[model samples]
Target chain A: MDDGAPAGNAGRTRPGPTTARTRARVGRLVTRAGLELAALLRATGPYATHDPTGSRAATRGLPAGSAAPPPVPQARLALVVATAGALHGAVMGSFAGPLGALYSAAKIPLLLGLAPLVCVPSFRVVHAVLGLADDEPAARRAVLCSQATLALTLLALSPLLVVAYASSSRYHVAKLVNVGVFALAALAGQLTLARHYRPLLRKDRRHRLALVVWPTLHLFVALQLAYALRPFVGNPRFPTEFLRSDWMGNVYLDLLWSLRATLG
Target chain B: MPAFLDLDRLLRGESTRPETLREGRVDLSAPRLVLATLVCGAVFGLCLGLFAATGETSDGAWQLLSSALKVPLLFLLTLLVTFPSLYVFATLAGSRLTLLPTLRLLVGAVAVNGAVLASFGPVVAFFTLFTTSYPFIVLLDVAFFVLSGAVSLGFLSRAVGVLFGDAAQGGSQGRAKLVFRTWLLIYGVVGAQMGWLLRPFVGNPAMEFVLFRHRRDSTIFEALANLLRDLGDGWR
Candidate 1:
């Protein structure tokens, strides 16, 4: 019986062809997913052609300069950027748990839906005040560029935010750090967009006004929209609610109060 | 050189030279030193536990285990309670040190305290063997703890002074001092509460040893009052 047991164990321990085949299949799937992700990031144009001339050349359907590659198509670029934004929001939301992910995922759509009604009109009014008629295309481009830059910046900073969230046991500090990271990313994105808008405003002396006005207006609208779509990152103080019952309370005030409580 | 040895030098105020402070920076960053510090803390805690269990001959081992465990737990709980506030206050005071380095400073201080406590262990053991009076033993243990804690606090203050010397010299010196004092007070209060929560560190010989005494009406303030009353009675 003992002699047969050794042989039986040897027979049972043989690696089957199915195991090798399954491993190969998994390897292929992972490679395919990675390639697709790379392609998606490339199409979004975050780290793409920083040369404005390249993008202008692409818009004119001309071959780009030797120094710069052709720009990605605007619609495809917009879609990818929006996707990145949603993904960033989702990752942030996941920090608070499952319900937070859902709340955060809804933020991108909320921003987009409100942009037409809020940001687009604000841009139009600014353009109109400056007497820059028929510059709707430029205005739209600026808006789109700003959104893309913000999304890309947030995506870039997501890893740091995730690390900070994961390492800390305290919910209050994590939430405060997350908010600080977002604010810093947003400020950086706005600066990038401001640089893009500078070329368009070269002829007008009052173009400087657009810089101040647009960002200020955008910030105001964004804050309001954020308040209305509360619980982007679920507060540990309260149970996960899809929306806060009261939108009247200011985030800054709440933050101060939380800081005080935490310190005490 | 081991970080704790360097720490001991710093605690003695014999090595305040800028280069020495910079060299001691490795203490906070080195994983080996961090591990050594924690192990030292545990060992010191064990010695304290043994001293605490001296009166309780029947359940000395159990009392020892409970007291030993509470030492590290008390340090951790106090740090958790005080760290965020310290970080915020330090930032406000314009200290250049980042969070990790600041945490290292605090941990190093605790490690220094542990070292000092371990050094005192033999003296404590001698006292334990000779003494039978409960109040006298309690007072001696408290005195040792207070001495160790003060030494640790001195180490922390000196470390902070070296790290933030420039900032302290600036206009924010008053604010920095205030922050430091406030943090010390907060640490004391939190430590007392934690000690209350992790009760019966020094077991009563009259009663059986217990890992935890069910917290009844005793707040930290009440415990302090009881200790004072015992001291008064002991004098009489």
Candidate 2:
């Protein structure tokens, strides 16, 4: 907005064009600033890596010997998930009856309490399955004992499950799912046993490959059981004897046919 | 194109469409299989006893021992059926069936099968009985076994014919001539089998056996013709 003065006179009054000497000085200052900025960036955390070198700083306030690095900000992740779940429960609750609403509400506390209990069976027993123990007899003994315990659990659980399932209006589909659940649990027991026992049995060294096969076998068996049992178990007070002959026998014949068809 | 190649191709199902069930036969070890079976059966028995204590149904511990005994018996029967015939066949072919490898192969296969059956058969049978009201699957499986038995009988017949052929052989020239004659008569019958009248008579043992028993040297050319047909399929 102002008029320009005479160039040489103004330059003399103020500063002249920068010479090579002054430019060199300015460049040095700029370089220093850049180095300082980079240092600041590293300290400010954006440029910092979360590798072994830098995580210590982030975990500084935590106490020593804490478990699993405390699930990697577990509280934050859990808080977000819980909030989402609550919102979901709200949507479900809007349509549910009083009993349904009550049941839904109880699930939150139940999950929180039960999640820790899961670590007990998993860590205490199953983790042993993958460990490097050469004691076959001991491993076998442990597996048998665990299986016995699990079998007992099933025995105890089945009656209660059957009773609850019987009480449900969805009894037909319920029994089928129960069959699948039973088969899966049995297969899981096999997997657990196989993991530990495989190293001992030379043939079972193939059990690592058996891992892929065994699950597939059980699932097929389950589906066949489901298809066969679907008609009978769904009906209460139905004659069990007649249904058994058709469904159970037919299923075996089909399996035998498949065996003959595939292997024989 | 080679006879050996044809044999290999037969085993691999290239020569036969929906290859003959005979293709599946392979050698197994006997003693190890038997041991495996016995151990498995006992383990299964004890486990069954233990589980019976916990499960809804109780199969007495006797189930296991009976199962163990039954499996080996089946093994014994299969050996009785297959081994004698196989030995006879090999003997007729001028091969020694009592040789160490042959004995090992035959015995091992039976034993291995017996062991596998001991482990798996009971479990399957129990569940089939448990789930399906009828023994429908068992019957179908039994039918397959029946078919296997017929095929075994055919092998036995071949074995018997070989024994006679051995008895008939006095010299390599005579034996070679006899083989050619026998094969020619067989093809003549097979060629006649293309007609309706011979169709019913084709598998008639009396007629076919006569062709084999009274065969002459002229049959070699027909066998060559068969080789041509076989190779043509492969090339196509």
Candidate 3:
């Protein structure tokens, strides 16, 4: 967890060593970073394609470049989200989660910027994956996903972010941010792809396998990606109520922290 | 010519005079819900702005611009989100209950939530002055604002469709499919429109509101003090 690619480029700086937890976080980060890197591999899964130049400027909705980049937007988003997560893990390992501190009402900056911005890059993928048939629906879904993602993620990360900001207590705000970042990335990307597959079962429409197989595979792949990296996530040690509450809140590590640290 | 919620008599209009609910009532058909939603949108903007302004640039000139403008920004944000947010919230919370009461409940919830979260943003910022620390509190505040509003809106979304079928028309909602199609429309179109309309007026500045100094505390305090100095209603 702690060693996870040093989030914001810990490679050059090199995060310090071991406390089983930090190591776990690092492992996850490293694996995720590896997966992201792997996606760009010449012959591989999600990151298989590569188009340096545009195939006549992506007339329809495709980008100028090929799918080769594996969606830089998603990757970039994952980068920021993951880095934030890494920062959070480091905090947790250092101080443990806190209940309250200064400016306790401030929203999670890492997340606020991360989720929406990241979505921007993958907006098309998500919209298509979700079930966008018409251009209106496409744009509409894109907007909804961003706004909804903002509101929901904000709601979801609230307690934990609050607990984190309020205390000098090293809660795993960074790690939480990463998990959130990835979960969102995977879901956003995969869900969009799923929608792409919807029209497929009948006939392979506009896209060949890009529409059907890619999204379908991506769903499993995203989950697998998240799961593969799960080993590195840290328990931010939040309060019980908050910990037990919310979909994202009830995960393994957070559950541990909430039960132990939370006043309620 | 939409309906409004006036659970209490204070807000006057063509009243049904339902004695049991509260004192006075107003036009249930007024566009108050819409207004409230817009205001909520504004508040969301405010909370977002304040969140952005957390750990700002140390430049005095920039600080001057930011410090001077927070309350107004918050005020505007609260204002903009008023109507849409109201509609959204009313839709979320009391899905089972009728419209007026639903809006009333939503209104009350936001008033409390906005005031608390808004006030709290600065206080948290104040205390956590040292670290460019995580804006955890702001995050919570955002949650408070969103969840409270969302719960209410989620509940009422269906009601919106049922009660104001016209308003709810066009948006798709298949269980096996997507939802809040209209939600997407309004936010994107409206948000974009609002952004466009306000952009020219808003001094093409970067939307760099989140800095981390807890401007909400001092700025809010200053605004209150200014209001007091003006004896509540001074000129422009």
Candidate 4:
């Protein structure tokens, strides 16, 4: 411990040519990944200027298809939802144990994916009824993109959950922490959605009505699903089951009970 | 399917455009609008009935059937009760819309209302599946009805404005617009009472499932106030 060489100098001396090459390769891979992630982050943000038709390619004197990235496919966005959702789910259930973690990892993606799918039919109807049927595809992409943003934001905030769990053993505090994380993530997703909807809104004022309808439907469904798939932060008083036995119970009723308990 | 397309066209404001209204008719098929309304009302009713169905009451199935049947009746009967007065006032105010065209326009508005309500069906059913609180569901349903009613009335109001205000060229048309506006209030009052008269839409968990509750002494407004107070009291 006492014989400390300079960190950078020591590493330089230890590596042979192959090791150095390997390290360089790894470094390049990491840099590439970092750039890709940064691009994704920028795309989701409101401030980023996106030209989906590859006009930037011509402007830069490159062939149109060569420089412009294709619009993110639904399959890839779904994959992002799955991967990022699983990561956040892992953190949420880390306080419980391995089995709980696995269960949560499986459920979070479903929560993200299914909630919107259930509401899409009605959303489509609303759009068609409002004479915005032609804009439905773009609107759907906006919804999916926002969901992906939500998942990524939740993943980014998972570290805070880890830290809170590390610092506190209180189960209720753990619940509050998770709730706080989710609320922040939801706000981020909503902002991204609104940003995505801005062009559509500019095209027609009725998109504003759709903007109101989507969240009302999504949140109402999501809340119940979240309640049903409970025990995310397992209580020490109970065994760590994937779902509580009374999983069919209502969130509104539980909330009332909690309020009464607190008041009494 | 064709009827649904017709309903869709009506929803797009195509049927109620200023030019279309100026032609002296709402461009909609009466049978199609009625059919769409029935399907949509039944869909919303099925969602409303989920509370009782999930409550483990012995008469849950019966409640479901009754609710499904009553919802269509609710709108149609409300229209029937309110239409005569609206017609009298509209004629008195010198609207050119004949009996059939006027009825068709009202039916189209109801179809819009039903469609909006049915769109909200999934939300209600989701809550009903999990929620044990009767007062909360009652309040939620009321809120949704208010929202859907507002939307439908907005559609009707716009059509009336086009028919009587923008299209027609006289001061008498302004009077026609006022008559329709006055009728909206009467429609709301009658609709609320009709809903009250057809009680047990969302069956109370504590009570046995009945087709209808005994006529309560209080008005719908008083009952709603009580529910609000009870809900605020933390009935748990």
Identify the leading candidate in terms of DockQ. Answer: 1
Instruction: Flag regions of model 1 displaced more than 4 Å.
Output: A1-264, B1-16, B20-30, B51-57, B167-177, B214-217
lDDT of 4 by residue, A230-264 (tens): 87878866778888899999988999999999999
Q: On residues A1-264, what C-alpha lDDT tens digit does candidate 2 reach at each position?
A: 101110112112234567756855765674443332222112111211122222442233236653223212324324433443333222222222333334333343233223333333433343246442333333333243223222322332232232234233354445554455345335434533443343334423433443443335434554555445334232334432212455555566777899999986
**Model 4 Cα shift for residue B99 (angstroms):** 0.7
For model 3 the local lDDT of residue B135 reads 30
Top TM-score prediction, candidate number? 1
Candidate 4: stretches off by over 4 Å: A1-264, B167-170
Model 4's chain B yields a TM-score of: 0.95
What TM-scores do the predictions have?
Answer: 0.47, 0.21, 0.26, 0.46
What CAPRI-style quality would you assign to candidate 4?
A: incorrect
- Model 1's i-RMS, to one decimal, reads 20.8
User: How good is the docking of model 3, as DockQ?
Assistant: 0.01
**Residue A104 alpha-carbon offset, candidate 1, angstroms:** 18
Docking class of 2: incorrect
- TM-score, ranked from best to worst: 1, 4, 3, 2
Chain B TM-score per candidate, please.
0.81, 0.36, 0.31, 0.95
Cα misplacement distance, residue A144 of candidate 4 (Å): 69
DockQ of all candidate complexes: 0.02, 0.01, 0.01, 0.01
Model 1 per-residue lDDT tens digits across residues B1-236: 44555545435554344554543242343233355555555665666566556554777888777777777676666676566546544434534344445566677676666677667767776777887776666667667767887887887776666655554354554455556666776666666666666667667777777787745334566766787798798788
* Model 4: colliding residue pairs: none
TM-score of chain A, predicted model 1, versus the true chain A, to 2 decimals: 0.66
TM-score of the first chain alone, every candidate: 0.66, 0.30, 0.25, 0.79
